[model samples]
Target: MGAMSHPHHPGELAAPDPVRLLAVRDTPLSLDEVFAAVGDDAAGGTALFVGTVRDHDGGADVAGLGYSAHPSAEAELRRVAQKVVDDFPVRALAAVHRVGELAVGDLAVVVAVSCPHRAEAFAACRRLIDDLKSEVPIWKHQNFADGTEEWVGA
Candidate 1:
């Protein structure tokens, strides 16, 4: 429908090139704010993933968690997010991961991927989170119900 559409590609198929990356902290994020920068009328599909701080992990009752990150974390996150979009044909991408002290059920991270089809959105979302966990400088500290706390991936 838009200039990005492929004439020969299936009607449901999406173009294999993405344009932007929007990433930030998880606290009180504005979905409208992040996607506003990346939205394209040409895009028909938008996929979003929100990672929340759960109450438990590995059978541990997590009461709270703390996270710390390098000062350059956001910049690096942007770079990596964009790279994933470029490598995967993501139409629009966003990633938000929080730092500092956080309570259980607080949002830990958020990632959104938009493309011409649902598959790219799903794929990109998965990869975005996977890459973030592996590559981003952000770290987490876990607090258990027993008042035990430990730094994770420091």
Candidate 2:
């Protein structure tokens, strides 16, 4: 048989696209912007995640860090967000990642998701952040206090 197709059940409507914002920017990330992007009146709950640059990693004191992204990074982020929306009853979704040099405690990424219930919103938000970290073509260059450096997720 040729390619098999799965069809929607009778009276079942397809889900509307819920992704509102997706960006990889060289400026600071704003939690308020991300949270606002996912605002949905029909949603019973909204979950948000913020990733920040820390002072230490792998037993080393971090001095600072910088992030760089490939040209395709934004497209890959869209793919990851769409996957989350397809798996959950997402009413709205938004994600933003920061590039360029960043100091400790600076926001690295922010993601938010809204759904009909709290659990779905939380789960979808978590999945969106985790997948964005692992699957996107963004790399980090971390500098340590000891004059050493390392690259992660390159």
Candidate 3:
């Protein structure tokens, strides 16, 4: 038997090539690469958001955080990115999430979106990161200053 293709949603055009880059890497993320990916002549505005590990979370002093991801993390990230593209007038998009251990000031994730207007770019960029955090199969192991550790979003 042959595989069956899913039908498109109402008013859905073919999935546009809005994603310029999407990835999950063990090394540090590059802000330059993310910004470059969303460089488009048609776009009048570009917005970028970078999430970094901080010294505290929920009132606890965090020494550092170690990120771990399931094998499907990248695929889930793409799915989230696609949703952003489908919902926005995105000219281009890029997102990268870092894995492995990171210090308080290390960059954990970077997302960028470009659109014809600044408002659209800002909204799309926000959606990309919010959805990515809620939907992706990545967990954070936080080490506290008092020698305690906890895994978040596991």
What does candidate 2's lDDT look like per residue over 34-138, in tens digits?
989988777888999999999999999999999999999999999999999888888899999999999999999999998888898899999999999999999
The TM-score that candidate 1 achieves is 0.79
| Residue pairs with backbone overlap in model 2 | none
**Tens digits of lDDT, candidate 3, 79-125:** 99989888988888999999999999999999999887788889989
Q: What are the Cα lDDT values of the candidates? A: 0.72, 0.90, 0.90
RMSD of each: 4.0, 7.4, 8.7
Judged by lDDT against the true structure, how good is candidate 1? Answer: 0.72
lDDT of 1 at 107: 72
| Model 1 lDDT tens row, 70-105 | 888887887778777666655567777777788877
Best by TM-score: 2
TM-score of 2: 0.90
When summed lDDT is taken over every stretch of 10 residues in candidate 3, the lowest stretch is 8-17
